[model samples]
Target: MKINEYNVVAIEYSLKDANTNEQLDTNVGGKPLEFITGMGQIIKGLEAEILKMTVGDKADVMVAPADGYGEYNDQAVQVLPKEQFAGIDLVQGMTLYGTSEEGDTVQVTVTNFDDNEVTIDYNHPMAGKTLMFTVSILDAREATDQEMATGVVGGVASGGCCGGGSCGSSGGHSHGHSHGEGECCGGENHKHGGQGHGGCGCH
Candidate 1:
């Protein structure tokens, strides 16, 4: 079937940086990543590309900085008082979590530190990098009514709630579902069909 909104898609992908030719992510020895189209479960550029493909198709796409994570912003860098990190040992390249001015917890990397100042950068790690996606569509199918209703494709039985205070199997992985406002793989909650914040580099 043609890939469209609400269709569950399974894909194998190799993500690279266009400029450095460095591989950033890949599906190696792991299950194919699955998600529903136009569901904001995936990045905008990659999702848009998937919509143009059919099951069993493959394509290599180059996503520009603007279409991907956007250009790096210098304003994202800030110097915090050294005392703010009371018990943590500060070091370059260390990732630290703290609340932002807006009250959202954000992940910032320690770029530098001195006796009284700590340089922290909130810019996304790949903010300025062009993303090159080598994508292979493994499978595609129409989602069930229940899957569409809960915004999750696989895992729970029909009429079962897997998220949002609903209880189900905790060990099984649910493919193509929104994480809502819970932590997944130690990362922040990701809303289905919405733009991701700066932490997980998937943005």
Candidate 2:
């Protein structure tokens, strides 16, 4: 059946920067990325197009910045006192995690720094970039009430690649689904389908 709201969907996908054709992330030969449909578990653009596909289908989907991580905001860039980042060796372009004002985990990149001040970009690393997703649908089915309620596939927790808060990374890159800010899907402690927040860079 075509994917619909709360349907558990699994797919193997490879993401690339549309402009530069730089491969960002992929799960082609690994665990399939699974998420609930119409629940904001994944990027808006990707979900919209995935709705048009069915199991066993493959296609390329392009997502604009607005539908992906959102446009890069100048206001998201801030210069804070270097003292705030004490105890860590700061490197340019390195991503750092911190709690936001709302107590959510926020990922920021070290853009520049000096002895007194540090410049960080709160915008997601993929912000303002169009993404290309080569996707192959592996499975799609209606979610049970429990699964829908918990946003967990099969309504049971397991330690899959990107499951249960472990973002299964390669070279420090995560290929899990991304939503609000840096929220990641399939986190066991937090409800999935946009209810919880975690760390993952793939969008």
Candidate 3:
């Protein structure tokens, strides 16, 4: 089936930083990632790639910073008073969540610390890096009524991917779940199965 709006698709992917050629994410030994298309569930570049695919098709895609996470912004870094982290053990190289000006939840990394200053970087880890994606379309089909209602494709009837008696991974890991019979996160479909390279890091 051709991947289109509301169609379910399943794909295996390997993601890397184009410039550094560093592996960023992959589907090896992991569940296939699912989502709804044209619904803003996946990254724009990936969505665009899916639109050009057919069932059983495979392609290697290179996404620029603009199409991926955009260039890093130095202004995103903020230095806060160390006292703000009082009561929590502070450590370097730790990741923390913070609110952006637009009130969106953002991930920040602790870069440095002094007697009173805590330096945090708000840029996304992938920001400024070009992305390389190798993807194979495994399955693509129409969404079932149940799947559409629940807004997901692969799990129990509760419509949630995790957080219930539904199928879940060990160690708090989870793949996308379906709410309806044919409903998936996007118009893709498939389960992940393969060997882990280093460890199951979900990437």
What's the TM-score of each model vs. the native? 0.68, 0.76, 0.69
Residue-wise lDDT of candidate 1 within 1-203, one digit each (tens)? 67999887888778788899987767645666666665555656777888999888999988886666557777777776788666666657665553343444454567888999878766655667788888888899987887677666674423221111111111232222333311221122222112322332101
lDDT of each: 0.58, 0.64, 0.55
Candidate 2: worst 10 consecutive residues by lDDT? 186-195
What tens-digit string does per-residue lDDT give for candidate 2 at 19-113?
99988777778778777786666777888888998888999999897777777777667777777666667777776654444445555667898
What is model 1's C-alpha RMSD? 8.8
Itemize residue pairs with steric clashes in candidate 1. Answer: 39-193, 40-193
Q: Candidate 3's residue-wise lDDT over 1-203, tens digit each?
A: 78998776777788777788877667656666565556544556777988999988989888786665556777766677777766545567565543333433334556788989888765555667778888888888786776666656643533312111112212222223223422222122211111111111111
Off by over 4 Å in 1: 98-105, 143-203
Give candidate 2's root-mean-square deviation (CA, Å).
6.7
Whole-structure CA lDDT of model 1: 0.58
The CA lDDT at 157 in model 1 is 28
Could you tell me how far off, in angstroms, the CA of residue 2 lies in candidate 3 after the best superposition? 0.5
